[model samples]
Target: MKNTTIALLGATGKAGRYILKHLINRGYTVKALLRKPDGLDFRHPKLVIVPGDVRDAETVSDWTAGCTAVVSALGQTPGEPLVSALAARHVINAMQQHNIKRYIFLSGLTVDVQGDHKSEANQAKSNWMRQHYPDVVNDKQQAYQLLSQSTLEWTMIRLPWIEQTEQRRNLAINLHDCPGDVISTADLAAFIAQELSSATYVHKAPFVASI
Candidate 1:
């Protein structure tokens, strides 16, 4: 918290809000960029909300400038044009410019990369995405490509169906398969918060679900 300032995008979305709260409550200084600043309701001394869109390269660069690490909880919009890949490019370029080394990215399990060996059932999920939601899948895949090829240290936490229920369980993570079909937002937030300094999965993509 002392030296680790976080530059967060998608800070207003469902998962992003939880991630933001976790980081803020944990005493991390968070600089969050939102299209609508008022989307955030609470305030903390360490929380700074910046009004901007993630797709704008200059805005993302400026927002990311002084943060020690970047945490992107950005998600795809159903009818909106692709946003993740473009945003990732901007974030990566900014990280290089600012010398920020860590990037913790959250995405759906459908984003396939080279080292993944998901089980049949898990792989089916990605296949379905590609068949029906090609744009979203393609966008996330490009984002992964950007992350993997970038110089900054990165960890992409691929998630299953996200639930908002209070029901809690132990988190199950695997490099080659998804352990379950769903994960609570609470559990996902905790895992991401812990990953910031853990370095356990840096430069790797892991499938996560609640068990």
Candidate 2:
């Protein structure tokens, strides 16, 4: 919108790809960090791809420098070592060093906030993730703690199961209960992009879904 450059982590992932595309299409400059730069096919004048590991603090710091804001669509893969917690620390450190404030992190409905009052369905979903992906759950929990305690203007967007559809539709958003059960990946990206410049959810976590 304002020729602003935002640093994006996990730009190669399913949701991250959509976020990247949406940001670029909206005329925002994106500096994306990819573990494998060669795997990305899209090229744009406003896109700057950085090849590095998110787990590497120095690498993340270097890539995040000089950006107006940072957004993460990171998620843990099955059996892979958890990087979310470590990456959060590095990203927060870098943002502080560079005086970049706005941070929007994409999370699942499984992660809970202090005053959250989830419905039975959402509770069941959280239990399932905790049982099946314990490490990821733990890592994400720690990341939440770091974010909640940070001075940075941060918003953690908690989403339900993500479907790989390009359709953008009405999304129910709530500060306590999860609004719905599922949402399209495209719509999720749209919400993140729309919130990039808004303070409605600053320093808060909100759950969103298709109603």
Candidate 3:
């Protein structure tokens, strides 16, 4: 895995840090994009901090050069420009340029996709998000559209509520429904790292949670 370097988006995000750590600990080199690289808490030989924003297509391409894969844990930020849609475009372009095939994106259950048999509870979660944070909902939904239309081997892992806690394993995975309410950050990290190479859910969106 030392030869496999992954370009990471949203390294400052709650899930991003843990994901980065998990990759580095597993001996996977990572190029993590950060707006404030000086604020990073730790360092490792396998981790390279790339200072930039995902919205910048040029920066995204430059950051992705020579990387084997891409993983994003980007989430919407209040009072900031939309993130997910732009990240999708830029990342896809970068991936194409490098001919990279694997992309694993972190998203939520609020985005409705075709073939999804979301339960009433999940539908309600989407409705509430659209009613309140409509812009974010729109952006993230657009991100999904872009990802689905691409030919790349992509997995959009939808999560429920997230909590910072001890690392857990043996995640419950569902294709038609969200099987649980919450997942720990460590577990999410583990899943992403594993899914990067597993191709277990390629070209599909799966709901993952703690069992």
Candidate 4:
């Protein structure tokens, strides 16, 4: 693909790191949004490290400029205001203004997509999140709703517990159910990078896990 420039959110996180490397290795230019410049290790001619926060509209607008797509691996942390919903709103607005399409968002199983027939184990995990991390779960659910309402082509990838391994295991991709147990960070990044130009899950949410 020509001019494969992408605006990446959460580039400093565990999954985000793998995603940065994967996209770069796939010959795509990446504009990574970061709250701080600390701890980032990737440097390349195709990589543009933008220092900014996702919640700030001005920063997000700057990051999305001249980008063909957006990929988010954003996650909520304790004591921090759940910003994924707000960030999604900002991203969607920018994409509309800039006429950019194709967005890929990373979500967990707790945020159920429509027609989702979650397995017993997934249900238990969702229940646990409701009991413990209600704010985080609620924010993610709101974020997914925002994506669903957008006119842009978007895919929300619901992932299981992500391990920091280099294993590229087989990932079961399903539309309505949790597919497997756990997927490695390497495998998840590979899927995201490949899905950037794919229409398989456009306007849909797919649950992915290791089989």
Every model's TM-score: 0.95, 0.96, 0.97, 0.97
RMSD of each: 1.4, 1.1, 1.1, 1.0
How many clashes show up per model?
0, 0, 0, 0
Per-residue lDDT value at 70 in model 1: 92
lDDT of each: 0.87, 0.90, 0.89, 0.89
lDDT of 2 by residue, 1-211 (tens): 7669999988888888888999999889999999899878889999999999988889988898879999999878777788888989999999999999999999988888989999987899899989988888989999999999999999999988788788978988999988887878888888988899799999999998876
Instruction: Estimate candidate 3's alpha-carbon lDDT, on a 0 to 1 scale.
Output: 0.89
Candidate 2 has a TM-score of 0.96
Give candidate 1 misplaced runs (Cα > 4 Å). Answer: none
Model 3: clashing residue pairs? none
Query: Which residue pairs in model 1 clash with each other?
Result: none
Model 1 score (lDDT): 0.87
**Which lDDT tens digits does candidate 1 get at residues 1-211?**
7867899988888888888888888889999998988878978888888889988989988999889889988988778889989999999998998899999999888877777788888888788889999888888988899889988889999888888764568999998777899988889888888898898999899889998
Per-residue lDDT of model 4, residues 80-169, tens digit only: 888989999999999998899999999998987769898888899999999998888898999999989989899999988889887788
Error of 1 at 18 (Å): 0.8
How far in Å is the alpha carbon of 183 misplaced in model 3?
Answer: 1.0
Q: Relative to the unseen true structure, what is the Cα RMSD of model 4? A: 1.0
**Model 3 CA lDDT for position 29:** 95
